[model samples]
Target chain A: MICLSLFLSFLQIGLFSFGGGYAAMPLIQEQVVTLHGWLSMETFADLVTISEMTPGPIAVNAATFVGTQTAGFAGAVAATLGCVLPSCLFVTLLAFIYTRCRSLPILQQTLASLRPAVVSMIAKAGLTILISAFFLDGTASLIRENISVRMIVWFAAALFLLRKKKWNPILVMALCGICEAAFCAV
Target chain B: MEIFQKKQRLPVLLRLFTSTLYLSAFTFGGGYVIVTLLKNTFVDKYHWISEEEMLDLTAIAQSAPGAVAVNGAAAVGCRIAGIPGVLASVLGAVIPPMAILSLVSLCYTVFCSNPWISAALNGMKAGVGAVITSVVWDMSSRIVRSKDPANTLILILSFCLCWFGGVNVICIILAAAAFGVLRSLHAKKGGSAA
Candidate 1:
């Protein structure tokens, strides 16, 4: 029963999570945290953090994490499989259709339209995370007390290192963590 | 699409599995980061998929209903090797997250209670935000550089709606798709007249 529920919830997540991994955040929160009570909010936040620090897609990571926390190794396999089944099915079908229809100008144009919309979605997800990081409780307000100076500094440094210096992103992530830990120690 | 048919099926599938495994295991931020890496590995290094094909595949992957990383791997896999390719790539994409998180879950208490780790995570979050912002900057700049006024307009409008207006992403995607169909129909009508 536990594994079944885990599988079902992740299947819902995999089937309905459109756009990308970040866009699936709310749905995962709903199923795992609110609906099934598989994890508390704090643990969910930790999951997000770990997802960021670790490799692979956030949805897959979430499925595995939640499954393990709720059940065991078998649960992890079930949830992870459920999470990716829709991706394999949908993408394969889309790939088949796309290869068949790619020559059509209409199909080409439609795919073109998706580019801007998708980029905008990425921008929104970035801004949401930025706000969540720099501001308390993810409030968008820029009031004096709401901002974290340390985070802002780190954000600026990261942006410069990434865009200007063209530093390796993984290295940048490690530096950011080390610096933050040092700051907290100080 | 049949480019790999000349090659031995087993080796091709094995390479696909290992390549995606390496990419997924190392990429931390996920989504576009992994996509970018896949482009590097497949398009730039392997020369199996073309530049244009990668873009289209990415579009389909993003537009589909699932995690972009897995979808992308599956899409690329299908394109390269067929259904068997999809199995290999999807397995490669999923294995790392499951294994890593499973290990993390085994030490959940220590991980959660460590203030130092949380502090590091706090910093990493800011860095992640910046990484995402850079990706957005790179992508939108590419759109602008393409000099397509319609696409540029869509970029700005969608960003505003989702960020400020709090519009659901699904609605925006549907609206964009509808707009594309309309534009295509209009062009067809014009073509017929000419």
Candidate 2:
């Protein structure tokens, strides 16, 4: 029953979410934290961070982590399938039909409108992450007093490399890991 | 419609699986990076999909549900072959994360206890935040450069709604879609890119 519920919840996430991975963060959070009580918001943010470190889709990683935490390996399998299978089925149907009517004006307009909102959703996810990463309580308002210099420095370095220099994210992440570990050791 | 031509059943599936798996494993920056790798292999290397078709597929992938990379692979794979191709592509996209995360989950409990490990994980969280910020900046700039005022307004409204108002994302998106349809209808008369 636990595994089945995990699968069904993630399947709903996979089916309903649009836009990109970050865009799906809120939905993932709502389902896991607010709706099911599977994980707390702090743990969800941690999972999101860990998911960011892992390869593959962020949504997939979250589903796997949450599933495993809740019900071990079989839970992981069930959750992953639930998250991906819906997309697989839906996209196949969409692909078959879309290829036939590629240029419908209505479709084009809808896509154009979606682009901006998608961008905003990603930004919202980023804001939530920044707060959680910096603040102790994971609350946006307490960030001023709870700020950690180490986190801010590492974040700035990552941003410069990623935004300005266009460094490889994997390399940046590895470096950030080493820097953080070293900082913590000292 | 002669794209990618005909291939025997088993080999095409194999090829799709291998290519997608290799691409997903090699890239870590998420959907767009995976999309680029797909383009390089399918469009540039194999000539399996035309450049325009790849763009269309990406758009469709974004507009639809699930991860864009998975959707892209399925859409392109379906175009190249058929149902088998979609299976191969999705499996290829999914397998890497499962394997990688399985290994991570094995250590997750152990890693959670150590303070040093926790610090590193927290630092990595910051890095992830930076990466997401950069991604949003890059994507937002492109849309802004499209010179559509409605795009800018929708973008701002969505951000405010999500950040301050705490409105449900799905509701915001639905509202934006309605706004988009109206914006495009108005643009048709004014004659600008919609």
**TM-score for chain B of all predictions:** 0.79, 0.58
TM-score between model 1 and native: 0.82
Name the regions of candidate 1 deviating beyond 4 angstroms. A1-9, A17-59, A65-71, B2-5, B8-19, B22-33, B36-55
Candidate 1: the clashing residue pairs are none
Backbone atom clashes (below 3 Å) for every candidate: 0, 0
Per-residue lDDT of candidate 2, residues A26-69 (tens digit):
88998899999999888787777667666688888888888888
lDDT score, candidate 1, position A17: 87
The residue-by-residue lDDT of candidate 2 on B1-194, one tens digit each, is 21344656677779889999977764454676566567657876788776546655665576678987788888888888878888898889888887777777778656556777666666766766776677677668877888988888888988998889988766776787787678678868787653
Model 1 over residues A1-186: C-alpha lDDT tens digits?
A: 999989999999999988776788999999999998999999899898778767788889998998888788888888998989998898899899988898899988887777788778767767776887899767978788888988999999998998899886657766888899999888
Q: In DockQ terms, which candidate is top? A: 1
Question: For each candidate, what's the DockQ?
Answer: 0.59, 0.45
Best by TM-score: 1
The positional error of residue A50 in candidate 2, measured at the CA in angstroms, is 8.2
Q: Flag clash pairs in model 2.
A: none
Provide the DockQ value for model 2: 0.45
Provide the overall lDDT of each model, using Cα atoms, as 2-decimal numbers.
Answer: 0.83, 0.76
